[model samples]
Target: MSHPPDIPETDAGPAATPESEESLEVLRDILFRHYRERIAELEAELKRLETRLTDPQILSAIIAPALGNAIRQKIRDAREEMIEALYPIIGQTVVRAVSEAIRDLARTLDAQMRTSFNPMRAVRRVQARVSGVSSAEMLLRESLPFEVEEVFLIHRETGLLLWHISRDPEESADSDLIGGMLTAIRDFAQEAFGRGEEGQLDEIQYGDRRILIEAAQHAYLAVVVDGIEPPGFRAEMRERIITVDHTHEETLREYDGDPTPLQPVEQPLRSLITSAQPQELSPTQKRLLAGFAAVVLLCAAAFCAGGSYLWQTVRRTPTPAPVVIVPTPT
Candidate 1:
């Protein structure tokens, strides 16, 4: 009864279908996979280069005498260049280690800040880590030339000595000297944090022995090591304090107060050091010079008085002798 289905117009082409689009997508996927594999190959090469750069080979065997006499010439040349380029390397070990330690501390603090919201507590934690080392004396003693008599840890912010370890059992230190040191420490810390002032020398007179004092930020760490030379300890200690200051104080806002109760200075001078300079002598030299000067002055004064007395006696007797001679001729 319905009209017969109309046949498509003879000019009309077949309709575009979803299956054709699916086929196109498959082709795109294959291309993508090919590019991804190429990218992965490039990344693997990059990783291999990075590993080689970081993992240098041990050169000992390369230069070993057993390898061959022919290579020995090359090895000798390399060693000479290295030795010249890195002079006094052992002496610089402390400076290098201290610098690395500071850098590590800075990195640790930065990481902590990124993870935590509050800077206050995070910074304090960092300070505690940086300043909590009790083994520094032990570590430094082996490398240093002289024996360490006393090692003091101080709060750089407050100029208060946090802990004092001394080797001398019989030495008693004056309280006034310690206080003066604290004052110097505070002054140094204020300057160091604010202006990077290097430090000032303040000598503490303890009877015959002298305590060489220097100011450092957040703490005046002192070694009552014997001798007059200011321990080059300053550079390493300064590096540590500066590190703590830059990392903890500026960004973290964590400041430490006089945490350790004011205790009597009980540390003894275990070692003494003096600078090696002809112009600047040790304590012994200064004392000897003073004694020598005193003896010379005394001798000069005695000679001057004796000459004066002889002159005065001759002048007084001359007139009397002339008058007597005139009377006798008359």
Candidate 2:
């Protein structure tokens, strides 16, 4: 029956909905773009790998190890040079991967070391600035018997050396030594901030020689004295010491109640302690101390033997009282 031509269903199915169609279109575009970018990146990587593989030396470096198994398998298969042909491919792959891994590792390590202060830029900054400069040339030479050899300034901010100035520009100092001195400055600064007592160390090793470093308010002065007489070194050091003293005096005098900018003090003897005691010990004093110690030990041993001995002897050894023990009359 030629029935009414089945009226085309006006109700568009779910697929015909505008929102559904739009979402589907968006999804398709995203997938297409993703695949295209992925393919491009993969192609680039492949091209780089191919170039690395083509080098004959890289091939040899890679495949020189799998010679036996490859040869044996190729022989059993009756191929003339199958192993030889396969070697290049295998070697190239291995070498490229290894090279990439090594390069990545090296980059990572370099970054880490920089962050951790491998070369210590703070200390280097101080060294580069003051090194080989003559801060007090004529004053250094005339005041002291020996030449004013070196001037090392430990940084107040970073605790790293700001610079090491040599009296003569001929001396070479190590960065490690500078770093160690910086550490010492930091430790001392923490310990001696406002206690009024400064710290000094005799015979601190610089590079190879021992230096008597005099720490000041914000800096330490170091002089090289290998075989030079202590008296001569001290004489030279005294001039620098006096210079530092006068400089500090002048600064304080100039400073009014107003807040003055804290200038970096180049006190060569900045670490000088007003309380440095001479270490020379007398033999007689030592002998007397020994005798006194012996007597003390004997007395201690006697007392320790029993409390009875201590009470009867050491404790009851009576002294003349202000009032004598008089007998009371009935």
Candidate 3:
């Protein structure tokens, strides 16, 4: 029994030591702490990645291309809502602008009519007809001759120039800008005075120059005239504008800012120039009339002198000879 116990103790001698057990426990505790910290760090990193994925810029970058059509559909679905939200403000703004424009137009028309009906205006018209001059020329002779210097055809909604014709072609350089400015001014006047859709700026005067605007359903005509414009002239302009609108209604409706289609309108505008120009006497006709008048005066003077001389001769000698011959015959 003593030999067996000695052989077993040789290998199982440290089995019940407190220090070894404590070392094993410390090793286990160290492993647990390290694993727990690593797991916590991994979870924090995962949470950061998740937050980045939810970011708008990153999300849009990942999904926009694939969902573009779906996004557009969503916007379309909300369009009615957007319009409903904006309608009241937009409608109020439009109403106010239109009302202002109408008031301004009414005032302008009243003032213009007052100036047109003056006694001097009638006298000027008469003088223009008698002198073979334009009424504008007769009225403001010292400044600029009354002529339609330029004509601009513009789209009412877009303020785009459809066509422009200028007596002085140089003035056409900035016609597009002028059309935009005109539209802006018209819009401003309308907005300022609370004018409505029916209101428009018909005329703008600056010194001797005047811009006569005629509005239609889709477009307008702006004529630059220097001098007093006759009512007939304005009527003629309106008629021409109407004719153009009627003839090219389809083209104008479909206009894409190309001026080529408006070429035919040049002929009508040129005709206006021809009609407005007064038929003045040429130098040759003036000379011929002067010479004819001189000849007529000379002939009248000779006939009067000849008749006076004959009457004096008859009175001096003819009565005595007539009495002697009558007595001899009896």
Candidate 4:
């Protein structure tokens, strides 16, 4: 079959004319100007994301699980550097703990040794065994010679003197001030050394006199003594304090710095004075003394004849007459 005649090649539409080219260039410039700020914003956002991805925190979060072993090995290799960085912090913690522990241990051991091997305590124990009496009774008898010069019941928090009694009434004038000073000292110790509530001031000594302190939850007892305190004396004082607390629990719990609520404790304290007084010898000691006296009398009778000649010489001595003196005239 015959094909149709081929048409001559020609441009489909308008060719690249100068006016069209100029119009396209103007349009491109307008578009570029309009989107310039948005394109700049997108570029800035992309740069921020890139920087975040390179950060250690973000990078580690992304690859941590897969690179766990490698990361750990790297850390181990640089362990000396890590330790150097942390040395000051770790060293301070360990040193402080060790120092406090050693100080507490030394203080405890010193106090225990002092109480255990006291010479007066040893003597009292020997005396009790020889007399066939209880050590407590013997201690009380021995301590009776020493006086409880003063006693103070002080509030722990405010350092107020709750109650005070003194062997000499005139000495009670400064009891309140003394209690405040003791409290201040206790606070200073606790704050300076970072001691906890369990720490307390146990005693204050000046020359031959001392004030023994017994701390409780809300209050403390201070007893002034002129001589060595017997071993059982502190125990007795603790017992009395317990009794007082039990009897006055409610009043103490709601105490508002009032001294009146603790009045009842005074009677019990006075009873201590009576209990500490010296006692007479027991019947056992009296019978032993009487038997010794009878033996002495018999021995004296046996020696009477041997001393008769000496007695006769003493009786032969002459007696001199008394002389009267007359009053001289003025």
Candidate 5:
């Protein structure tokens, strides 16, 4: 009777009862009721994330930094592989940029050559040969005419920049630094070269650039010039500095760090930034041109005389009569 009644025991735990399932359902409903907005928000965020993941631009933005890092790391690991892959792209970019720059330079050269066909250029060519420099170098030098780039009014004693003006919109100069340097150089020159003499360094030149300094009692004006300065340019600089000093004598004497007090001087300083004047022919150049003109006139006179003589001879000579040739009967 005991063997017959023995049943199979399961390994599983006790099955869920109906009451427990009902209690669980009630708890789930309570959670949903309390956090309904939170659940909806999480669902919306998940949907938005999915949408963003499908978008190519957003995906690229998300992956760009990582992809770039990975690429850089790969390049670091295998430089040869990356170089071989991107060699053509880099090579082409470099070649294209270089070619464009060369083309621009060639166009500029061609324009200069075409425009520089004048008597002045011819005279300069002769002068260049006499100067023992190459004609190309001479032409290049002459092409860059004199121009005032910037002007700085500085306190003579303290070397503080008072008023500054520039012709070029792109000319960003440290006026104070330039003034200080000029002052230092002047001081050094006075001590080294002209200690006893009552003189100052008037000009500081480097290559085609010149710093023309005009000193006064309180302040000095420094003019930045490019290329060779024309005649009377120094006198103009002197006049500018003198005028500035005379106009603002009281203010300049009581010099301080503030440039606002000397703001009015900018107008006068601006006047110094004049356009480059056209170069006039030298005495020798004028003489050369005169001689050339005389030779050309003489050649013209000789040609006219020869043409008139030929015309007269042709008129005096007798004309040859036309002869009719009768063909023999074949």
Candidate 6:
């Protein structure tokens, strides 16, 4: 006999009776009735968002506020990457702008130097032109003599002393303290006066002494001088700071409290003092220099005299006579 066809079992967990299905439906309505309006609003919002994504104007209107903040946050997070990527676009432009700014600054300073400030200015200017000297150089020469009293290398962010050298024994203050003070003064000036400008405080003049600042990547230098800055003082300081910054880039970037590793930096700093136009000589030093010069002259004279005597001795020496050779018997 053929077996009866098996009936399909209920796969929806358990088969609900008509009354239980009606009870579940009633329970769902009771729970969702309060949220039906809010649900409809959300569905409409989602549909509108989908539409907005396809429409540029609508999307911009929606994203403008958060988009700006998001972009800024991204830029802050990946600054170096952003810079590298943007360099191709803004690099040359920024370079040209900087060059122009520097050129303009030079011209402005030149104009200031070229202007007549004294009664004898015209005469001196003419003389300067005649002597083939730049007015800036001439003015520098005429300016009161200056001496570099101190050189300080400091961390840009923390203002901690990296290295220090001083020629002024009287004002031998703590270098770390001075560096912090300088940083404070700079911050105050920039904030109170500059108001978040791109540039920085370059010089601070106090009576006869002046502070000159040169900035680098991770560090900055402060040069204290008495009297006036010479023509090349700024350039020299700039070059020196750049050299130090470049040479010790990694060390400077990772600088800790200890500065023993940067002892070699003092040698370049020493040049600033010695390379000044005028270095006063003590009487003892002058005498020593004179004696040294005298010794050099005496040595030159002796060398000449020795050469003449040798020539005479060679002339007077007799030559060896040639001897006849005897034929060998075969």
Q: Number of the top candidate by TM-score? A: 3
Instruction: Report the C-alpha lDDT of model 4 over 7-77, residue by residue, as the tens digit.
Output: 89986876789999999999998979769878999999999889879898987777788698776786789
TM-score of each: 0.25, 0.25, 0.45, 0.43, 0.43, 0.43
Query: Candidate 1 lDDT, tens digit per residue, 1-330?
Result: 789999767876687689988998899988798898989999999988776666646344444555677556656869776566667885599689999987876675556445644333433344456867333332332222343455555555554445555565468465335655666745665576647564465555454454544444444545555543334655544554455344334322343444333332222111112222112445875676678669989999999999999999898884644444445555
Candidate 6 segments whose C-alpha is farther than 4 A from its true place: 1-131, 134-143, 277-330
Which regions of candidate 2 are displaced past 4 Å? 1-149, 155-163, 167-171, 174-199, 206-208, 230-232, 245-330
Better by lDDT, candidate 5 or 3: 5
The regions of model 4 sitting more than 4 angstroms off are 1-127, 130-145, 194-197, 274-276, 280-330
Clashes of each: 16, 10, 13, 0, 0, 0
lDDT of each residue in 123-145, candidate 3, tens digit only:
55676899888865554442324
C-alpha lDDT of all candidate models, in order: 0.53, 0.55, 0.78, 0.76, 0.83, 0.84
Q: Give the least accurate 10-residue stretch of model 6, judged by summed lDDT.
A: 117-126
- For model 5, the superposed segments whose C-alpha errors exceed 4 Å read 1-54, 67-91, 112-117, 129-177, 181-278, 318-330
Native-to-model Cα distance after best TM-score fit, residue 278 in candidate 2, in Å: 28
Which candidate, 1 or 6, has the higher lDDT?
Answer: 6
* Top-lDDT candidate index: 6
Q: Root-mean-square deviation of each candidate, in angstroms?
A: 28.3, 28.6, 26.5, 25.2, 11.3, 23.3
lDDT computed for candidate 6: 0.84
What is the overall TM-score of model 4 with all chains considered together? Answer: 0.43
